[model samples]
Target chain A: MKGRLLPLYVVALYAFLHLPLLILCAFSFNSSRFTVWEGFSLVWYRMMWNDGALAEATWNSLLIAAVSTVLSTIVGTLCAYGLWKKNSKLLSGSLYLSLVTPEIITGIALLATFQWAFRYLQIQLGMHTVILAHVAFSIAYVVLVVMARLRTADPALEEAALDLGATEWQAFRLVTLPMLKPGIAAAALLAFTVSFDDYVITSLVAGVDSETLPMMLYAMARRGANPVVSAISTVIFVGLGMLIVASERLQKA
Target chain B: MKRLRALFLLPAWAFTLLLFLGPMLIIVAYSFQSKGIYGGVVEPWTLENYTRLFDPLYGVILLRSFVMAGAATAGCIVLAFPLALYIARSGTRKSLLLNLVMLPFWTSFLVRTYAWMFLLRDTGLLNSALLALGLIAEPLPLLYNDWAVIVGLIYGYLPFAVLPLYSNLERLDKSLFEAAADLGAKPWEAILHVILPLTAPGMRAAGVLVFIPCLGAYLTPDLLGGGKSMMIGNLVQNQFTSARDWPFGSALSLALMAIVMLLLWALLRRDGEELL
Candidate 1:
């Protein structure tokens, strides 16, 4: 805590965190198929752009993330609002459980549930299943983010609106909903990030026709370290990094 | 009006019940059934799945997963403590540092793991650099092992460890440090005796956050450990996939949930509800 060594250690720690990402980005431009330092080229980026399955996967990921984020944000905001009005220990407790539970278990449980239900429903794991799974897991995060904002908000505004001869719905819609927009936006951004980045759960519930971006990335990674994977990753890393920073700014605002 | 208020919770509750809780219940029931001759589940409602977990094959795996997850949790603490403290004490740079930490948390974890894979592979960046620098005669066998898995877990979960500790440190009484200094304690002594004791709860929270995920980690071990260093997660995955034994998979998952839930119960009892 007291030496020049501390500053150096902090720098090294940041290096450990950021250096791999920088390297991946840099190598993404390398022309060689292997890791050797070849001349700079956009070949991998072009290949990633041209890959048909990869394009479809990206579309699927976006669609899933968009739908799930909207669904979870609406549901979670309402749930958090209700809890704020009158706390339910059981409800909030389960939300915490969803957050803490590991992805593998959740993935398997949802998979099991889908398979069991399919016996009667006559459907297979597909985009709908993955979207539902995303909503199920992501509702907790949205609720937490919104609940944090709700706790800081003054409840008296809604009460004042109600006392002024407004209906309860009008009071909430006019007073509370306006105050919650930024939090809802932040939570929606977070939900989208979580849904898009999810691999394990998405993989389990996605049928062959519904592969998401992370599933495709996983397949490419498993095949070996290719420059195409690096290119795609660099794009995602930059995109999501901006999204998160924007969410933080929104939360602060 | 009260009933109308409850309607706000209806969608969330129905979604949770029909999807999350309902699936969990299905797995719990399946755990008590036996493996069907073909694949799924066939029930006389036997406890063989849980009993079979006592086999030494799984015992070794469960033990190894515990040790590796523990090692990763400890590593995250060691690496994150100073960083968290540094961030808590900094002024203008504090928010920037916090953003940097959360950046990886929001991005694709699979991409970051792939970054590590790109570095650690035999024909990868680390080996390529070392060979170029003449640091070694041959490439070190860095990937596809227990150490790789441990390192991956630590890297992936380090941000989770840092944020909790930082939040705790941010709330600490700065006067305590000053008092310790006024009482003639050196900086090291103040940190050891004063700061360390106060941050213990935060460390526990960080431990729970990191350890639970690390214990049930599938992708990290699967990609880094490479079929060799199998964790309990991988074993459970195998049962459902390649092994085609859903009942055993359910039992394994239940066993995992039990361990996680027990840990959560202890933490909640000790720390109230804020640990999440």
Candidate 2:
């Protein structure tokens, strides 16, 4: 009886976890906007497709995520290599601050800095500022992932490459870079997702023209139940879900 | 060789120093300054912003945030401990179970929170299903309250609690339990004496992870609590956005950071080597 009850408990917990998401997905198909179902239809999905502001927000989000991911992955990979070679405890410890600091605090700090700088440089708060904020936080994750990968990697492989008449740069390019590919990929994916999904920081730093998908979703949700939110959410859910699955497979490979 | 390595580190360290550390310093400075009559900051620093935090209204908000966060952390611990233990003990299907726990974790946070709004709203599926089953006479008021906010917080943070606990539990030596049994200790006694003490670090880490985020949570309370329940995060957000009080916001942000830093310092003191 105890053994059977254990599985039942686990099953109930999983049900609790997944039921809300499944319900949201299911209701997105309801023709009626209310929770009470009318007939199944794609009207909400079509409405999301026709939302011009949302489309712009989605584009901005993709742009910021893409830029921040690339920049952070490169800088962070180098930083990881530097930390591994240098073993700088202070530098490594400081990275944890970004991870632990609350998002609201981080957002305001960045906003204050940007406003301070813009006073001198005359630059406006827009996509550039948003990308900068994303990269600032994202580098922490990338460094962490890469550093973990570096720890298990055999340092002697690079030494061997150096002994074989390869330049230091060549050795890294030929040996370390190849080995770190999975970590870099994982880091890039993580940075992208984080930048893409961020709301609080983005909302605070984003100007009128630089709205992202999360910002749009917040505004819509704040107004009331819009079936378009359900439609857009389903799309994001499926897309990111696939990305995570693919990344997991890649890590295993 | 050392110089070359330093060159590689320059870009990242410089970026962090200029952007991350630089902004944080500005926030500290802002917290000291006086709020301008027309938004933003003014010269001639004062402690007024920090002092303003002691006002009864703000005091209540801070207290409420801590209570909510504490409750959520406790709830997560209760829900996550059993599940973590089950997965740790399970054979062959461990990865699958872990993945199941993580799938929703990786989904968009805003999207998941919005899903809860749909589920707990008065006319939501939960109420309708119960009504259809003749289990209720009318729709229940499930959303726009403290319970809704707590549910959302737990749902969002459960995986964070689970992951740390699972990692710690999975690493425990099975022989320890067997040894306790050999000594004629009961199962509950073994759990209390051996397992709980051993897993305390994981529990602490989980609590910190869930509690810190819950304390700073804005979206959950704003959306689920229908803007009625004001947490510290919402207060800071309002000070900057709608309240147009930058110095006050900076002070609040600093206060929030101080609490987080204190917790982190405690964590570091307890588990000095593992956090990094």
Candidate 3:
């Protein structure tokens, strides 16, 4: 009885989880504007494709995610290695602070920081400011993920390379870098996803011209239900789902 | 070699210090200052912003945020516990079950929230299906309310609650249960004394994970509650955006942080170190 009931419960839970997404995808193909069933159609998808603002937002999101991923991955991997070499309580504690801090708090704080800097620098709150904010919060995640990976790595591997007449840099480059590749990749993916999905912080720090996908989606959703929004959501859902699956495969490899 | 490694750490440290810590410190300073006539901060310090937090309007918003967040957390716990237990007990399908739980989380949060809006709106799928079934004469007022906000919150954070509880339960010692059985304790008593105490840490972690974000959630209430309900997060955003009251916003942000810090401190005190 328990065994039979368990699978039923699991199925029910998963149904609850995925039903909304599935419904959204289904409605995007419905010809009618309302939620009632209509004949199949691709009109909403075409409308979404034609949306210039959304196209711009997607481009901005991709660019920001890409730049921030590269920056955070490099800085974070190095920092993780440093922390591994010498565990500093203060450094680790500060990393924890970034992880635990609410998005709104981080958003406002970064917004204020940018505004303060812009006063003297004469720079605007555009893609650059958004990138900087993305890099700031994203580094913590990369550091944590890489640090966890580093803990599992053998310190002797690097020491062995060192004793084999290789220079310190060569030992790190050849041995430690290869070992940390999986971790670095995972961190990059995490940073990318986070940067891509972020709304609160991006909305606060982003200039009017630098809106990201989430920002656009929020704006559209606030206005009202549009079938085009559903179409865009389906694209995002499929795209992100593929990315996650690919990353999971990479981690396993 | 040690010096070289430390050198590698400098960039990250400098970035975080200049950007993360420095901005947070700026917020702290801004919180103490007065709001300028135009928008930004002014020189002379005052606790006026914090005092304004206690006013009835803001107080009601704050109280409503807590109530909604608390309700969502409670709902997640109740729903997640059984699901997590089932996943943990499933011998062969555990990883698959866990993955299913997490799959939705990987999607964009705003997208997910929007999906919920589509479901709960008056002409939404839920209402349509119910109407077709003759469950009601008219569409029920599902969206643009506190309950709708709670549903969105719970939907977003339920996985956070589940994953932790599943992990803790997965690691539970079956031998302990066997021992309890041999001692002739009732099943309920065994669960109460053995299982519950062991899973307390995960429960606490789940509570923290769910509650903190829920307390600061803005998108759910804004989209699902149809602006009828306002939370602390919405209030803070308004201060920064529409209201253009930076000092007041900073003060509110600091207040939220203080509450989070207090919760963390309490958890640290209870757990005596590592928090998940």
Candidate 4:
């Protein structure tokens, strides 16, 4: 009786977890303005496409996600590699601290720092600050993911490559690099998704001219139920869904 | 060779020092200074910002945030444990179930929160369906309350609770359950005496994992609670934005950080310095 009931409970919980998002996705295609469906249409999607601010936000989000992902992935992978080579309790502890820090605090801290520094430097918060902040927070995630991959990797293979007269760079490039490829790819995907989805931090640091997709989506969401918001959400939902699926496959590969 | 490996650590360390640690240190400094008349911090380092935290208004907000986060963490543990057990006990579908749990988490948090807003709004889907079914004359106040905020927090952090608990359950020795059974322990007794005690660490970890995020949650309360259920996250965001009180905001940030560090220190002491 217990065994039979447990699975049923699991199914119920999964339904609770997934049904709202699925319903939202379904309503994104509704023809009418209200929740009561009036048959399916692409009207809202059309509106999302035509919105100039949303288009600009999308461009900004993509640019930041792209640049920050590359930078964080490189830096984090190297840091993970370095840690693997020589363990530093202080550095690892700091990474964990950053990971566990609340997004609000991090956002404000960065905001305070920028406002203070920019006063002296005569600069302004914009896409540059957002990108910098994204990289800073994202590096911890990348390091954690890549470090998990490194722990599973055998050190003997690298030593063997060195014993066979290959240089340190050559061994890392030819052997370790190929092995780390999947982990690196997974880290990049994680970083991109995080940077793109970020609202609190991005909102705090973003200038008037640097709105991202999430910052825009949030404003629309706050105003109430707009099908245009749903339409954009569906786009992001499907887009990130595909990316996560790919990342999972890469990790398994 | 040693120097080459050190080179690999340079970029990350520099980034951390310049961006992460430096900014945090600046907040510490700002918290002691006075808020400028306009929007920035000024000289004359003082503890006025910290003393202002004693105000009843900020105290209520802090207490509310604490209670809401605690309630949400408890809800997540209750909901997550059964699901985690089922996933751990599953044979062929364990990985699939695990992936399913993580899928929603991987999606945009704003989209997920918006989904809840779409459901719980006055004229939203839930009310629409209930009204169509002759449930009530007026739409129930489903949105913009403490309850709605708690639901959102649980939903957002449920995955964080599940993964750790499932991992712990997976590593348990099955023979222990059989041993309990043979020793005259009933099913509930076996779970209470055997499984619960053994998996306490995992549950503790999950509690911290869920609690910390819920404590600092901004989007859920802001979007779902509609400013009715103000949290610490909202309080901090408000100071930086409309309040335009940088010193006060910095002080609030430090207070929040201190609470977090207290929790982390407790967890680390129990787990012996390894963070998952």
Best by DockQ: 4
**True-contact fraction for model 3?**
0.71
Q: Give the TM-score of candidate 1.
A: 0.98
Off by over 4 Å in 4: B273-276
Assess each prediction's global lDDT (C-alpha) against the native. 0.91, 0.88, 0.87, 0.91
TM-score of predicted chain B versus true chain B for each candidate? 0.97, 0.94, 0.93, 0.97
Q: Is the docking of candidate 1 incorrect, acceptable, medium or high quality?
A: medium
Better of 1 and 4 by lDDT: 4
Instruction: Give TM-scores for every candidate, taking all chains together and pairing residue i with residue i.
Output: 0.98, 0.96, 0.95, 0.98
Q: What TM-score does chain A of each model score against the native chain A?
A: 0.97, 0.96, 0.94, 0.97
Give the candidate number with the greatest lDDT: 4
Off by over 4 Å in 1: B273-276
Pairwise TM-score winner, candidates 3 and 4? 4
Candidate ranking (DockQ, best to worst): 4, 1, 3, 2
Candidate 4 C-alpha error for residue A39, in Å: 0.5
Question: What is residue A31's positional error in candidate 3, in angstroms?
Answer: 2.1
Count clashing pairs, candidate 4: 0
- Candidate 2 per-residue lDDT over residues B81-197, each given as its tens digit: 889989999989998899889988887999999999888887777888888889999889899888899999999999989998998999899999999989999877888999999
What are the per-residue Cα lDDT tens digits for candidate 3 across B23-79? Answer: 999999998998788888898999898999999989999999999999999999878
lDDT of 3 at A187: 80
| Alpha-carbon runs more than 4 Å astray in model 3 | A1-4, B182-189, B272-276
